[model samples]
Target chain A: MTERKLIVSRRKLLRVGALGAGGLMLSGCDSLNRSEGFRSLLEGAEDLHKGFQRLGGEGALAREFAPSDMSPVFRANGNREIADSAYRQMLAGGFADWALKVDGLVEKPLVLPLAALQSLPQRQQITRHDCVEGWSAIGKWQGPQLSRILDMAGLKPQARYIVFHCADRFGSTPYYESIDLIDAFHPQTILAWRMNDALLPERHGAPIRLRVERQLGYKHAKFVMRIEARDSLAGLHGGKGGYWEDSGDYAWHAGI
Target chain B: MSEAVTSDHFKGGDFVRRHRLSTRIWHWINAVAVLVMLMSGLMIFNAHPRLYWGEYGANSDPAWFEIGSNADGQGLVKIGDATIETTGVLGVWTDSEGVVKKRAFPGWATIPSNYSLADARLWHLAFAWVLGLGVVTYLFWSLLNGHLWRDIRMSRAELHPKHVWHDISEHARLRFPTGAAALKYNILQKLAYSGVLLVLLPVVVVTGLAMSPGMDAWMPWITQVFGGRQSARSVHFLCAFGLVAFFLVHIAMVVLAGPINEVRSMITGNYRLPKDREEG
Candidate 1:
């Protein structure tokens, strides 16, 4: 009889204990779910994100090279070149007629030919390309600094971002990417014209490609056809900027 | 009925049988995932071959102790024909000379740097995604169904120091009062589970992601949070330590609780409760 009573009392105590534990856990959940606190946390996280970008300043550009460090095998990732007839024809002609059209929010819209781009003072750099899928390769790249081109075209004061329009298309929509002015004028930022002392191959981005060296492989926009300076990206295709950005929700600032 | 008779065979009462199918699947999956993660994680850690923190980075000065070879020539032993060497600045060391040496710090075996970091990273990342998805889905399901707020949650009464002390004392004596007493998870289980889920997992994920150069742009705070990339790596290892500790305690508890019945319920999603022998 005494054992039965002890068990009954213990059972009641256990119930109370469980109830107490449940209450503590709820308080923790409440802290996490608080609207204002959560929002502030996100804002703080974004600020820290920007701070990192600033820390890797324009001076933090990838090292320039003398064509020696280029890998003997610069294995191409994904498609070598678009199978589209138009792109193929351009490639056949050695891309002499190709021009990089810079327009949108620039004071002086310019259609600079590939030859004209080469005439400008060029910078060469050896840098590592880190792929998002987790591989890294060091290669040599030579090109005009993007800052000089933007300056030549004369970006409008209102222009806050520069969008790279590429010849490569995922399907019906052509591939395009955008970056804020901070990245736009970064000294390391260049429109690479040559790789390993040779003209950029069709498999690579033939006439021109943007080498935002600080970012991942996807950010390296190849087959550049146009440059659009803009304040707002809301009007762009899918409003996310890049193909992967639209499809995979890739974070816009893919800096390492 | 047959079901009732079968239910009477297990200890812990009817509550033990109430685990849902989803819960059972997640439980076993987590078990397997954790084991794989731990083993692979250990193998990866072996590469760096040494552990340190704060101002004491892997190559930092004030040399704590170095692995591989040492001046004292201690902590060396032959396993099979291969002569393996060990040394210490602290703790104890047996040298290649068959002499035992003692010091303030211990030199550890340089993990055989055999595996490719890239491959190890691939395995770690892929398994991490599986672990992450499982956790996210489990948390979401539990929250939606109020399980988070109810089952594993602690009530105000349980928070009382006196109550906690009483439970601790009871646990020390191995006197688990059965029946309705077993209806809810004990306070110890609640604390351990909550710590593992809420704290350790997040720390592990954050430290791991922080080490990535790709996400460094959007999540630079990771570097700041963990001091630097190397520090983040250290923290990641520490968090792994905490997780392994929790896992050991968890397995031990399951064994003590009744390994066969616990394992069966987790696997088969059914448990027979223990009843009075007289009633049978």
Candidate 2:
């Protein structure tokens, strides 16, 4: 009877010990997460990845899939619709009057209406959109090359980053994103006005969206209102160059 | 205590250098790195909680596997048409704070102990550099030092079915190698180590790279080899769990073979071989 009691108590002790150890570990990790210095050490890995990603030519193009390979229903994410009065009015009129303002550090500041953008040279390719959340979707995006537009508005010597000020707002702050010259001038980088052989839907960033194919989905700013070329990303909202990057502490360079 | 007994070259029953400095260093670093990577990777997986095949997969698409909570808040892991309840472990669990969470994989099993995809990615990518570089350097150093060929590489004789079966049966019976025999790895050990080092580690790294959109531009063939990005992700997930399974078995083996002696061998490179019971 005493031996049986000992066996049961020993098992209970073992169970308690295991749970205690597990709890310690979990809390230990949480404390580490709270440490600012440790967080920086972790974030420092991004520089190594940035260097590694740049090893291949900056002009490298993401893989383009076949027509049938496109997702049947490309899931729309983030801000699907804008409740802003101006944005809603533009959407109601089929974005006919909407014009993308190209300014800041450019030799020529221009405002090209939707019709004007459609008149430019258009290139369409089916490419995969990888989200930071770890899902992927393929869709054919058609638009004039961003490089062509950049060339038309001649980038200034100081201009290094291209910022897209989007129409939609997440709670009050408008959605915005920026890319360095390498990605800004990428062949696949375009202000897409059409998706899957149809005009861009409101849910999928109507009028236009920036498709920086090589980067993650969050880097691809939707419902773009203005394109501004700048020397640096500093002094912008939260100064991280992208809405998600600023708000959620997402990596500015999301090539992965 | 006699001076001879404590001396490095002391006359003893059986004391030998079992691990190289390179192997010991890499082993410990890899232990921490793999744990961090796996935990953080689980947190990342929680964001989607679904797995699919082909180049594209999203919420609307049919996933071959998923972990989610039904409307009743009961955690369920679904594989095709089959469903398994995973309550209090995956899909739903009470965190240490006593707050209920509906995320796939409990907080205890994930890094940060809370939901933060950004933080998880930070931990994962950072250690990925360590893990990636460690593998490359270890493999290179092992090859140069003859550690790969002399220790891990299976001989033709050892690869024979009879030899492998003998090792397996002995292992099943908990009859580990004794004295001098303990110095050299048996067929089962060789196979397990080589499988992890040569096949599993390399496959996980390549599959991880395949998931990168930037890598698609530089190495399109990688995605093709895995069938698609999602397929590569599935392969990555499987290989990670494979490593976890190996880790469990490895820990069990260490415990069964005498934890103190086995752990000390890896740490100090000196092993005290198990005594031969039949000799007595």
Please give, as one word, the docking class of candidate 2: medium
Q: Which lDDT tens digits does candidate 2 get at residues A1-256?
A: 9956964775576568557856766777888888999999988887777778889746788888899898999999999988889889999999888899999999999999999999999989899999999999999999999999999999999999999999989988989999999988888999999999999999999989999988899999999999999999999999999998899889998888
Q: TM-scores, in order shown? A: 0.49, 0.93
In model 1, where do residues sit more than 4 Å from their true spots? A1-48, A55-59, A62-72, B1-280
lDDT of 1 by residue, A1-256 (tens): 9956965775576567557845543343234324465434433433344464565443454433334533445656644688888778878897776788999999899999888989999988776565554334457788899999999999998999899998887778788888888778877789998987789988787778888876767788888999999988887888877876676545566653
True-contact fraction in model 1 equals: 0.08
Give the winner by TM-score: 2
Model 1 DockQ (Cα-based): 0.06
Alpha-carbon local distance difference test for all models: 0.64, 0.88
